[model samples]
Target: MARPGVPAPPPEPPRVGITLQQLRQSQGLSLDELSRKAGVSKSMLSQIERNQANPTVAVVWRLATALGVGVGELLGDGRPAPPAIVTVPAHGTPTLKSPDGKCELRILGPIDLAGEFEWYELTVQPGGALESEAHEPGSREHLSVLAGTLEVSAGSDTSRLKAGETARYAVDLPHAIRNTGKTIASALLVVLHAA
Candidate 1:
């Protein structure tokens, strides 16, 4: 498939181990801590970070998840940065489904805001609930219902919000949002991280 007098494309560079090490350190995570969060053995992670071992796809996936980054961010070519203006179409947005499969959340914010903050469009089927564990201290969540009715509960207090209603609550304690109406519930949710 080569054209006359044209050179073949250069091969991809070898994976750089420093990327992983830097990310872990920047997050103030030790090898043991990252191992526990990634579900990978500490020894294996050590090896990978030292370029002594080649990680499998699953291992890389777990590491990416633990680092709160995409796998491409780890293996991307070490080239100059591109322009800052980025666009994410609706079809390209990342989505997460609840464990029970009755709720869906579409990430609407930039990926760089993963930890500091996040925005999402959440949809819950009737009779479904989205339960969440306590977030970082001082973190809060704001939800504005766009359709149907939602029961927002934080700890012992619960409130009902209908279409065009909004509620803000501290998320440092266990919380849940249940769709109490017979129709699907849609809401815009913004989570602010603790300073």
Candidate 2:
């Protein structure tokens, strides 16, 4: 709704646009190949490559992983030279939410290390659960509670951790991080994939 003399604001442009075509071409991957590898539709991949459509962070993550490149590279931020320090503002970091919307995972690790080694700040609202399917064989996770309490279940085993406590367990089987407390629970999670 608009006021008597007020006009509606213009629609915002898509957030993601980068050198996707160049990266795909350099890797000798056709749209179909990349689509299959990234689990994206061919049309969507084409649109993204042509900068005709914007992809969500999850899509960007998948594409970067499929291309074996960093998210920064996909975003056209090439690291031609090593810098002494690189800082990313908090607001610039990507975050993923669980389907139920009660759990949030702030991606803290670089996309380039996604499959091999990754970390995230996990936040779960009371009574929320971050259920996860089995990861790669021999995969493991280390979680250190930062606030409140969290219950972790790996396979048939379960453990509870409070602030300042850590738990390490295999992620090769189905697992879950649950906040049974009345308050939100946060933890620093690190994942390591087998070579």
Candidate number of the best TM-score: 2
TM-score of 2: 0.59
lDDT of 2 at 49: 60
Total clashing pairs for each candidate: 0, 0
Model 2: how far residue 4 lies from native, Å = 80
Instruction: Encode model 1's per-residue lDDT on 28-57: one tens digit a residue.
Output: 899999999999999998888788987888
TM-score of structure candidate 1: 0.57
Estimate every model's Cα lDDT from 0 to 1.
Answer: 0.88, 0.87
Off by over 4 Å in 2: 1-80
Per-residue C-alpha lDDT of model 2 across residues 85-111, encoded as one tens digit per residue? 568899989999999999999999999
Considering every candidate listed, which one attains the maximal lDDT? 1
Q: For each candidate in turn, give its C-alpha RMSD to the true structure in angstroms.
A: 17.9, 19.5
